[model samples]
Target: MNTFFHIWKYPILLALLTMFGLLAALIGTGVWHVLSWITLTIPAIVCIRFGMFPKNK
Candidate 1:
């Protein structure tokens, strides 16, 4: 259970962020759009960070 949570944590967070961003963009204006952009960019930033500087194992 602990291992499962540990492994799935970031992915779940990213997925939730993506969902919120999409919903925010679809359902509102002004500040919501900005919020959506920020939320949406977080996952992309995480991906780019991991992709560009992976851990050496």
Candidate 2:
């Protein structure tokens, strides 16, 4: 339902960005590999989601 997507937006956006970064890295673009590596980790996104937006009850 709608609720699920709202709760999982972070994971979804992370996955999409990860895919884009990987593709950019594979294409041999400068600086993309560095960004790709960053997106692949969890720490980068943890604060972005929970820190900025506390979940509502």
Candidate 3:
């Protein structure tokens, strides 16, 4: 994780996601639908992995 940020940084990823989302919204077609679906899943997976995990109690 550290190495990834060190090399590329978060803003790059954010920009890419934002661009894809904008493209998806403006052009709601076949390939764009698939691309946006795959792109949006990133946040869903992150939320499940980091927020919805079972914690030791």
Per-model CA lDDT versus the true structure: 0.96, 0.75, 0.74
What order do you get sorting by lDDT, best first? 1, 2, 3
Write out the backbone clash pairs for model 1.
none
The reply for model 2, stretches above 4 Å from the true place, is 43-57
* Residues 1-57 of candidate 2: C-alpha lDDT, one tens digit per residue: 699998988778877877877686898766877877776655466768778998786
Q: Could you tell me the C-alpha RMSD of candidate 1 in Å?
A: 1.3
User: Between 2 and 3, whose TM-score is larger?
Assistant: 3
lDDT of 1 at 16: 97
- Identify the superior model by TM-score, candidate 1 or candidate 3: 1
Model 3, span 1-57: residue lDDT tens: 588777776557856886786689569888888888787777667668768785565
**By TM-score: ranked, best first:** 1, 3, 2
- By lDDT, the better pick of 1 and 2 is 1
Rate residue 38 of model 2 by lDDT: 73
Every model's TM-score? 0.91, 0.51, 0.56
Candidate 1 lDDT tens digits, 1-57: 699998999899999999999999899999999999999999999989889999786
Q: What is the lDDT of residue 2 in candidate 1?
A: 100
